[model samples]
Target chain A: GAGVSQSPSNKVTEKGKDVELRCDPISGHTALYWYRQRLGQGLEFLIYFQGNSAPDKSGLPSDRFSAERTGESVSTLTIQRTQQEDSAVYLCASSFGQGQEKLFFGSGTQLSVL
Target chain B: AQSVTQPDIHITVSEGASLELRCNYSYGATPYLFWYVQSPGQGLQLLLKYFSGDTLVQGIKGFEAEFKRSQSSFNLRKPSVHWSDAAEYFCAVGEEGGFKTIFGAGTRLFVKA
Candidate 1:
């Protein structure tokens, strides 16, 4: 891919339903990140994957929020029992490595929980 | 805890006017600072970044940022504003050896003719 790619550009889910957002990063990138952008809000860090090391889940808002990445490729963000507050844009970014190097971002998945 | 603060929620500037957006960050050690721009319905793109060396760093799209360790501030600036430059700007900071980077709330710039 020329850049990071996200699936389902948009998603509409009823409250209490589960939603999944996917991301396919650029080839050979060694780091991936997940972030949530609320309406008129900043990027909220969700999770980070670096190579084969353990993921940094410090930013997940709650137990309902979880994400997974296989190697340095595709990653998925899953939200269980989604609530109205879950409505936001989920963004995925991959970088050459960790340490806050340049990040290539995807257009993101807009999730609307009604 | 590391954090980045962008005091202005939004600002309006006339096209061709000089611009400045303020940012402040808190980190434990030497910080890596960055400015990212997001256009409508688009993903964020790096404007510039600062880690070491000169306090002033240049970035793409004619954007520049200055890292002031004394005040823990990394401010973005442009000599002239362009209507096409209207967008949301984010300031971020990463720890010296940490894996994660945190972003500021963002400052939306409005370019008026």
Candidate 2:
């Protein structure tokens, strides 16, 4: 893909339902990131994937939030038992490499937990 | 902990008027700063970045940002505002040796014709 691609541009779900957001990063990019943006809030770091190394999940807010990536390609963010506060925009970005490099972003998945 | 602050939630400007968006960050050591713009129903696009050297960094769409380490600020500026420039602007900061980048709340620019 020319740029980072994300799926489920908009989603509305009942509280406690699980939701999955997908991201397809640019080819040959080795770094992927997930971020969350609440209404009228800044972007919150969720997690980071660098190569085959263990993903840096330090930013995950809770156990319900989890993500996975395969071979530096497509990535998925799964939220289990979503809460009303989970309604926000989930953004995905990828970079050629880590360490202060420029990141390419996707349009993001707008999730609304009703 | 690293954080970014964009005080202006919304800014209105006339076409051809100069614009400035304020940003402040909190990070230890050298900081990697970036400016991104997001138009309605569009993905975020990188405008410019300041990693090291050259406090003044030029970016696309006639946008530029100046990194002031002393004040912990990286402000985005444009000499002339265009209708197309109406968008949400964000300032971000990345820590050294860390892949995670923190973004500001964003400032929405409205250009009046």
Model 1: per-residue Cα lDDT at residue B7: 99
Chain A TM-scores, candidates in order: 0.95, 0.96
lDDT of each: 0.92, 0.92
Tell me how many clashing residue pairs each candidate has: 0, 0
- What is the DockQ (computed on Cα atoms) for candidate 1? 0.81
* Prediction 1 TM-score vs. true: 0.97
Poorest stretch of ten by lDDT in candidate 1 chain A:
A49-58
DockQ of predictions, in order shown: 0.81, 0.84
Q: Write the residue-wise lDDT of candidate 2 on B36-106 in tens digits.
A: 99999898999999999999999999999999999999999999999999999999999877788889999
| Per-residue lDDT of candidate 1, residues B3-112 (tens digit) | 99999999999999999999999987999999999999899999998989999999999999999999999999999999999999999998777768899999999999
